[model samples]
Target: MRLTRRRLCSSAIALYCLFSLYAAYHVFFGRRRQAPATVVRGLRKGAAAARDRHGQAEQPPLEMEEWNPWEGDEKNEQQQRIKNRLQILNKSTKGKTHISVQIWSKAAIGLYLWEHIFEGLLDPTDVTAQWREGKSVVGRTHYSFITGPAVLPGYFTVDVNNVVLVLNGREKAKIFYATQWLLYVQNLVQIKKLEHLAVVLLGNEYCNNEWINPYLKRNGGFVELLFLVYDSPWVNDVDVFQWPLGVATYRNFPVVEVSWSLLHDERPYLCNFLGTVYENSSRQALMDILKQDGHDKLCWVSAREQWQPQETNESLRSYQEALLRSDLTLCPAGMNTECYRIYEACSSGSVPVVEDVMTTGSCGNTSVPRPTPLRLLKAMGAPFIFIQNWEELPAVLEKEKTLILQEKIERRKILLQWYQHFKSELKMKFTNIIESSFLTTNKP
Candidate 1:
């Protein structure tokens, strides 16, 4: 009986010790296993919260072993390097300025004039030498040319102080896309990324204000200046400047070769008109009047039904020769009283007989205090025959036939001098304005 009790006591003690060991194992080893699981769960919850705050979908958290604490630090260092480079570039450009010219390559006149103006303003010596040598002068300025939409985004990287956009408002179909691009560019201006914006607008024949006003108004404060072909009385904005003539003749024809002797020489034609003749236009009216008076025999007139955007090399040469040989060029009003013929005639010392009557269009504001036709040309002191009616042509023709060669030579000299002076004054004013308003070192 004693042996049985001792064995039973030993078995009970052994079972009690095993139970204590099992409890100890659970308290130590089991906690270590659960701790990693708990940590993983907490990390996932934090990642989920971060995603929610950012309005993004929750993504699986990277394993703890894969996490790199220095990743964000490396990204911050890269950004700092970029900022430093930009600051260095800005400092280097002090006392010097850069300008970006955004224009359509097809607007040949605008392209030519802007290039010429910049060349004269920045490097006149080179331009004069090239001209004297009978060589074409490619202008060198701190200016970059951007022609198409594809190049626009690349322009953002150009370190420029000012931007000049040349717009042809006559192209009705392209205005919508142009407006959108302008608006996008305006946003950059709003953020103070771009400094100044300017526009050289080629006014439509109809002088439709609708095509441009929306863009002007949408970014009113952003635009620094505007150069418009037609100056309406209603545009009292201080930023607007009048552009008197298109640069076509100076670009395509050799106006520099014209001399007093050439202009004074006797010619067969009394007047010339070389352009498309629109139905019901003043051109058609002028043609009819010339035909009735039998003046076609004395005038060089070539009329066509459709307007050609581009002139062939032969046609261009013929046009230039006609201007050189003629005493007067007929510039009848089409959509507007102003035409390229008037400017071309001036280049060749051929007097322009402009039809002064305003055509039917949505141009010039009559309500303005000083509403006048061809306000820009009048402002520039252009000497041209301005007649209200085509019926008065016979009287002018008679007067021209009566004038002596000396009188015609004097007139040609006066016209040539005036044209040269006009271009010089324009270059000076444009350079001064740019220096004062855009190229100044002062910044707010």
Candidate 2:
């Protein structure tokens, strides 16, 4: 190899260019190939320093929320009053009072009964409009005016439920207040030793309200019976209950396991014959109607609690008229109590053919009425009967028919008299209470 100065220089230049390209490649990609030991040492030192400085307070753990029972609806005075009134009425009556707190509320029913009683002694249309408004035999308004506290006064007014108080002087004054949450006589039962029912079915919603059956069963009433399909508050909708023989089974009670709504499930027609005013009380249930092929003046009608008058119908007037036209009035259960039919029938001077006319709800906790419809019927000389079924209906009706008119008149007299007596008793009680309250207030 001959070495020249220019050739030597070119070879040196080529060597430098190749070294530069190799350094560039190493700077971009080869750095990741292995970290410098100094860089790794610095990062480790920085992390240790940061941890040592901020370790004073520990972090808190996450927390959870709590639960409450009365979350949905707030407790109010109205509810309190209802509960209190029920307690008081139970105490004062020593567990007496029935038609169960006015059939809805003791106060409302008292007032209603008073109006009817007064009207029976007088006339609905005869009074002045203003007077009529106050003393009208019937009312149609519906309001949610809470029934417990405020004007109604709670239980210990030694107070009362389903009671009407005439605030003024005596019975001569006027009714000023009505109590709520009443049901006195409803507490009594013909308990026949019951345990748990197989299944309770309410033809209505299966619910807490449809608990009458359970209450009966628990109280040694229907010990051997199980529930079948029925509508009640607990279930979702209203429908007939049916169960397979395999799925449904239970022991039988010595007593009949009948629906609480009717006197007898099979013999509702017997209701017609048990009592009568101007009619025979000895006819077979449906035979009398079929025998006469029915009378135009004496008609039988069936209605539910929620009946509404239409454009052509008689409105609320028809109900009243129907009652007035008949010597007999038949009532059944729907929408809680007997509904308007009870008053409508009573107002028309008609005898109510009810299985449980003397019954009420369990809200009041009062003792059942002592002298029953039978006793009262005897007193009024009214032809009234109580039957367990339809088979005994017609003969009873036929026997009582001749005297139906007479008994109808007498029943009205008795109802009015009883209402007056109630007013008298209520007045006396109120006088004592007011006197006591006024005296007590003046004492201190």
Q: How far is candidate 1 from the true structure (C-alpha RMSD, Å)?
A: 26.6
> lDDT per residue, candidate 1, 1-444, as tens digits?
999999999999999999999988876665444335545677777777878898665554445424344757997999999999999988987656443333322233454455444332222323222211112222212444444333443344645556666655666765654565567668767777667777766666666656566456345546677667664443444567766546463235443456646666876689999989999877788899999878988998889999887767799888887888889998888767777788778878888898887666666767765455787677779888889889899889989999887898888888877777777677666545555666553355
Candidate 2 TM-score versus the reference: 0.31
Q: How do the residues 1-444 of candidate 2 rate in per-residue lDDT, one tens digit apiece?
A: 456877999999999999999998876767654545654564565556666887543322222111222433545656888899999977877733122111112222223323333222222333222222222222221111112123333322221122222211112111112111111212211231111112212122111233234323345433122222222212211211221111000111011111222221122121222112222332233334534635312344542323333312343344434444456665433322223344344333455555432223321113444423222223334333344443444565566455644454555566544434543443343223323332333344
Q: Where does the lowest 10-residue lDDT sum fall in candidate 2?
A: 244-253
TM-score of model number 1? 0.66
Q: What are the clash counts of all predictions, listed in order?
A: 0, 85
Clashing pairs in 1: none
Off by over 4 Å in 2: 1-298, 302-306, 309-313, 335-340, 357-392, 404-444
Model 2 global lDDT (CA atoms, 0 to 1): 0.33
- Give the 10-residue window scoring lowest on summed lDDT in candidate 1: 131-140
